[model samples]
Target: MSKYWSEAIQSLTPYVPGEQPKGSNIIKLNTNENPFPPSPMVLEAIHQFDTDRLRLYPDPDASALKLSLAEHFNVKANQVFVGNGSDEVLAHTFMAFFRQPQPLLMPDISYSFYDVYCNLYGIEAKHIPLQDNFCIVLDDYAQANGGIIFANPNAPTGRALTLEKIEALLQRNTETVVVVDEAYVDFGAQTAINLVDKYPNLLVIQTLSKSRSLAGMRVGFAIGSAELIEGLERVKNSFNSYPLDMLAQATAIAAIKDNDYFVETTQQIITMREWTNQQLQSLGFKIIPSKTNFVFASHRYIEAAELMGFLRTNQILVRHFSRPGINNHLRITIGTEAEMQAMIDCLKRHPDIISL
Candidate 1:
């Protein structure tokens, strides 16, 4: 409310990220972070970073890291764009391609950041409602506007839109850009990156945070036609030439190149997710069919708020949204087997209040 603040800054509503509680013993499943440690190669890369090289400015374009990503995804270096994180990549995408005469369309319940980005960029947003089961219905989006973007394994609900459906949307919305935020794709969803070669307007954004277990490193990227990447580069160059530092560049390349580690960790998470879903259901929680790394569920008998509080008291934290319609559901991240066991044990000890 200060007069000195600019209108944009004053009016802006920032996105709230998940809590990263500071402690050694907290069983943190609140944020959808990978429970496994990153590969030893990534650690070695960071540990071996040269202090003397810190004085020199990092490559403004992050060429080496781009090359590694290009090779990993089998795309041309020019077709990919790197950023501080997927959020930054998304921010650039909204500014460069999404802003237009017609409003951008997204799922009503989505990565909360989408609305914040719309507000920040002053782009009008039309939130299309999900189906009764919380799945994205492609037919409703046919009368769309400027652009379309949504997570593949749609967030919160953890339901995924198939690659075939994604292709259908791109075919219809040829003129407008279609961004697929694939932050959780590696968990189960098939990537739309396979379609980028055919559809020039299709842009797929991904992050090293979830699958690669590099959330601490803050590296994310987008794959599309060269022209789309150029638009993001223009926005990035206009803002910060060196969005990625030297150590981040080195570590990111290492993370992407460690194929064995990436496969093992993601597969483990997927297995754990299936186990968790079965366990939760056995305890009377109606779990959403999830293809992502987390599960969204609500117990038939217990109140969502009360369950969340009980979990917190037991020091097992999971995400509980305060937003309408989803207030009763909890978004629980799939941690290690032992962590899941501990959570189950805690739940077993508690009474079924709704039954009482």
Candidate 2:
């Protein structure tokens, strides 16, 4: 609105994050965050970290953290790239490999941030629509483009594409980079990290926020060929040399090392998601087959916006997008058992909304 603003700033429509209400009684399922606490080892690491280290800059390379991720994922150290979060890593990826001659290809109903990054970097984008069941149709992506990126268990819909399909896309399109955003892969979907070694153009992005329960710490990384890793590093260093601070690096390293804790927590969320799906189905909601930490569902009779408002009035918050093709559905994050039971109780209280 101001003449002082740059052209890019003036034309930008920023991404809207889920609401973080300030209260203890509210059942918050709007944001897809882990409902469990971080591993005990992560807490121990945080306690052991020396506050005096704040005086010095963290290792510019984040060498220790990268090595941990490499060992955990069975990738070489040179093939790993760390950043402030997956969002920042993705931003650097757009600037590095996606700004090519052809427009970038992505799902029409994937993460909203993809479009935001495109606008910010002036990268033209070609949106490929998902199938009727909300699953990605790989055949639609067999075309010329600068690059390709989509969530494995796609956002809002919680539908996952098979690894065979992903590999087939990579096999057919070897010319452009393919970025698979696996932010929720730990929940149930198979990771594409294993194929990174086979395909030089494959880049798999992940975050510790969801399954690892470190959303507050803000840590994310990318695994790919050394060439792609180097490209991301160049963009990262040019933007900010110390993207990962001392505490964040330490916390993330600890989280990665505690494999058992990570598995237990993620498995619990997966189980809860299935139970929640069945419960919603019993109440006449058509729940999508979800492999992530959330479920996408729509009532047979009630409107999504109306149900969203009803839940909010009862101190239960879930996500509802006004976008086309999905405006009738609501995305509900899997909370603790008690919280979910409370939500069910709330639904029971409003029997009028549910079909017999």
In terms of lDDT, the best-performing candidate is: 2
lDDT of 1 by residue, 89-172 (tens): 999999999889999999999899999999999999999999878999877889858999898889989999898999888888
Candidates in order have lDDT scores of 0.92, 0.93
Estimate the overall C-alpha local distance difference test score of candidate 1. 0.92
Candidate 1, poorest ten consecutive residues by summed lDDT: 347-356
lDDT, candidate 2, 257-333, per-residue tens: 99999999999999999899989998879999999999999998889898898899999999999999999999999
Error of 1 at 214 (Å): 0.3
What TM-score would you give candidate 1 relative to the actual structure? 0.98
Which regions of candidate 2 are displaced past 4 Å? none
RMSD for all candidates, in order, please. 1.2, 0.9
RMSD of 1: 1.2
